[model samples]
Target chain A: MESFSRIPSHIGIIPDGNRRWAQEKGYQKKDGYQHGITPGFQLYEILLQYGIKEATFYGFTKDNNKRAKDQREAFTNACVDAVELLSGRDANLLVIGNTNYPAFPEALKQYANHRVHFGRGLININFLVNYDWEWDLKSLMENKCLASHEISRIDLIIRWGGRHRLSGFLPAQSVYADLYIIDDYWPDFKTSHFLDALRWYQDCDVTLGG
Target chain B: MESFSRIPSHIGIIPDGNRRWAQEKGYQKKDGYQHGITPGFQLYEILLQYGIKEATFYGFTKDNNKRAKDQREAFTNACVDAVELLSGRDANLLVIGNTNYPAFPEALKQYANHRVHFGRGLININFLVNYDWEWDLKSLMENKCLASHEISRIDLIIRWGGRHRLSGFLPAQSVYADLYIIDDYWPDFKTSHFLDALRWYQDCDVTLGG
Candidate 1:
């Protein structure tokens, strides 16, 4: 593996198009979220290998809960499973979101707001569950504290499934993020897709308007 | 000349690469900003022809003032010129920025915060001068109101000069913007580039995370 001279300290992941991927594969929309779990693990291992300091994954959004009942339950459960999967790993995992909402997973509420160490805690992992951009920013207005205040600024944001839009990602943190998009769906995660993004990041100005 | 059945009512423009474009043309970096003015008018006309309701153009940023003295002056003057250029046109013009700072142009102080109607006010134009994402969102924390409260949600964000990053262009409003990148520099503005982006946006699943 070619090592990067300047690896991004924090990477934001938008694993999109799972349902579309499942539909194309002739599976129920609910079944797509299950397949996305392995990709999360695959990306985690890759991040660990690269010694990336932190990562934030889009688990499910508040708007995402607007999905059909079965689809919503599937993705919500998938997020819980993903967090549990990281429990035994060497990660400082924290799930940030609106836990007050019923869409927030009951099993994952333990990981919300505060970071819990799993093993050596080599990398910081932030999983956004039932997250909303308005809800995230509203904290600053209503409470004078951000729910996502613990997470640092994102250096690069990689989105799967060919969407160019941010879809309400952490706006404050992602202000200067170098965005990379992959046409492949989240279920069809490939190491090369991530590697390609890293290579592209090397050439970015990364000057934050300086 | 073809009209779109579904035109994005509000479009955000990130006209990047003025310095690079000037350097490539064997001109001083300061000269780049002057050349970018024509494209602004061209884009405005196109938007008016298509009956697009609102548009936002990224002027200089607070960070941009960190550049060389001449370069800062050049871009600052360019933003002032761009706003003045729109004064006689049929648009509602507003400049959002930190006017308290010395970096903001004196000529643009009147346009800040409040929207001034031009001839007939057929379209709304927002020019972000000395804008910062942190500063824009910080208003919510300290003042309980956004500095950019007048702007509506951005439907599509078009960036000229090949960069895929947002570089802090109205973060709150751009949560669901369909980002389109054109490798061509701002000085090299072609109507076809805007047309191509519209064509791409036509296929976008603009369903805000639903």
Candidate 2:
């Protein structure tokens, strides 16, 4: 894609609205999660085509641990499967955050190792499990670890269905990041939507350059 | 005191140029910090007269702890003394985190207790000691522990020499919050500047009246 010239080096996604999508389609919530995999795959492929090097998917937040065990297990399995499939791709995969619930660190660790063996970086498919934004921010700021200059240089950020608040993910970096918000459920996001976001990002880059 | 009608409910100060202020005045940095107390007192009186309820003072951040222990101890003692004096005036005081070098919680607990004993909720003073904006913002967004609302609902936010990039304070509340930045050094802030900021706050409040 010629538009690859403007694709972001790192793209973060807030995958939201799995329950709503499932209910809307008269499927069990687990089914909604299962269905979500297709769109995720499509988006990943499109990002790859556009030459995006890094993608962070907001999978299960710490809050997700509150769901029923069966649902949680299903979601976790989906995540592991997604990671396994993506491992075969050229891009790296990382699963971030401490997997505290379901005591699934071993499972996550095993998948992460597999991804690495497949040639991805140690943290390529990052999943923020049991993450606390407040503690992290405090540590960074106090330690003077904020990479302010680097972050302000970002080209684009794509938010899927989640609201537009910094959420402690690179606040300093966002000042210069072109932002795109899609109203559709994250699980329903398609390749076309991803491309549309990329187009908007390209337009922003051109405008900013001019 | 006619400006009291336009006073800001919240005011923030960045005490910069301590070493420079000291050097210019032909005094040691310690002397500069001591000199800062006089203007600080004047500012407090002005804020009180103007009916401002919240005043955030940027004291030592985590980075400050890296200074010689003797110097750090001196600064901490000075801060403690200042709080003691303010506590005598029946002020509601809070110590905000720069989070890297945590002040002894006991110190703050003692001061808070003293304030409760003094019987005054009319004045609230907070020291953003080693404060990290990222942690604060993240807690507000993910924890649900923070009372979440629209960002637009925030009456006013004052940043004294603070940068604009949200840094880590992301997912800005849905409501729009009024922002004010002052150029004056925190230690040198005067009653006139306080009054001016208050007037602006009043104007903003009126413009966005509930």
Candidate 3:
């Protein structure tokens, strides 16, 4: 693995193109959940080994619920499985999203929302499920309870898909995030791609609009 | 100019690296403003010619106010001059920024914020000066009068001078903006570069996080 002189303290991951990958692989979208779930656990281990403190995964957005029922169910089940696997391990798990959204009732309910599991590892893993950009800000606007208790400014945002746009992942928090886009589909993602993203972030000259 | 199958109705331009261009040219920072001012007017004309209706320019940010007094004055003067020049043309001019700031006391006094100058041209131009993302959102939180009355969602956000981060420009509005980055400095920016950005936006498969 290539060494990074400065690894981002907080990194955001947008896992996209899982269903598309399933189609490309000539499998039903329901069968694609297996590929998506395994790599995320592997990534969490990789990130922990790298000693990265904070990482947020854009697991599911409210808009994703608009997809076909079977597709939505498959993605949700995949996300829950990943979260359950991660929660059993060390580190804090924080989920930021509207749990009350009619589409998603209980997604890793025990570990979903703002419950942090005190664990052996030092890294903090946040799973953003059913997250909407406006709703996140709407909470702030009303001086109401924040969806998630703790949120940090993301330093590097890696999107695994061909898309270049943010896709509404913590819009305010990503104000100065250096985005690294990967052409590989989320399900077919390799660990090498993750390392390359870290290396790419190291090459960025982040002046923060000075 | 190359044709685009899909042109963004609303575009946001982040004009960056003007001072760097000046330094590279072995000129004073103050001299850079003169170069930055001209292309903006030219861009407005280009947008009008291209049949683009809405355009916003990051003329100055609240962070820019933190620079040396002379530097701030020079840039502020340049922005005011650009706004004045655009105002004279027949287009709706709306400036999105905090006017009470010490930096920009009187920038086209009567037509500074929210005053629409409905002109013969179909293009609508907005110049953001002394604008800050947090402050803009803070008003909505406090129930106080907003700094700017009108704001539009940006479809394509093009930043000059090779920076990828948004740098706190309309965070909520840019939730799904396809960002286009140019290595060319703002002063040296060309109409061709603008056209390329439009063309690039046309190619982006913006699914809006679905």
Number of the predicted model whose lDDT against the real structure is largest: 1
Better of 2 and 3 by DockQ: 3
* Model 3: pairs clashing at backbone N, Cα or C within 3 Å: none
The TM-score values for the models, in the order shown, are 0.99, 0.49, 0.94
List, residue by residue over A1-210, the lDDT tens digit for candidate 3.
Answer: 567888999999988888779889999976776788878878888998898999999988887877888988887887778776876789888877886766554756666666587568578888888788777777765664335537888999999877878888887778889988898998887899889888888888866655
Question: Which candidate's DockQ is highest?
Answer: 1
What iRMS does model 1 reach? Answer: 1.0
In model 1, the Cα lDDT at residue B92 comes to 95
How well is each residue in B1-210 modelled by candidate 3, as lDDT tens digits? 567899898898998888889999999877788789888878888888788878888877887777778788888888888877776787888877877767664845566666576657577888788888777766766754345447677899999988778888888778888989999999997988998888788888867767
What ranges in model 2 sit over 4 Å off? Answer: A2-5, A111-124, A129-155, A166-179, A202-210, B1-210
Off by over 4 Å in 3: A144-149, B144-149
lDDT of 1 by residue, B50-127 (tens): 889999999989878789999999998898888887897899998999998999889999999899999999999999
Task: Tell me the tens digit of each residue's lDDT in model 1 across A10-107.
Answer: 99999999999999999998999999999999999999999899999998999988889999989988888888889979999989999998888899
Q: How well is candidate 1 docked (DockQ)?
A: 0.84
Q: Please write out the lDDT profile of model 2 over residues A1-210, one tens digit for every residue.
A: 544445567676767667777888888887667766778778776765666666667666444656777777777777767766767765555555444445354556654312344454422344444433443334343444432222223456666653433343444334345456676887878776787877766554222210
Candidate 1: global Cα-lDDT? Answer: 0.91
lDDT tens per residue, model 2, B92-138 = 76665533335533465454311233346567776654444444444
Local distance difference test, each candidate: 0.91, 0.53, 0.80
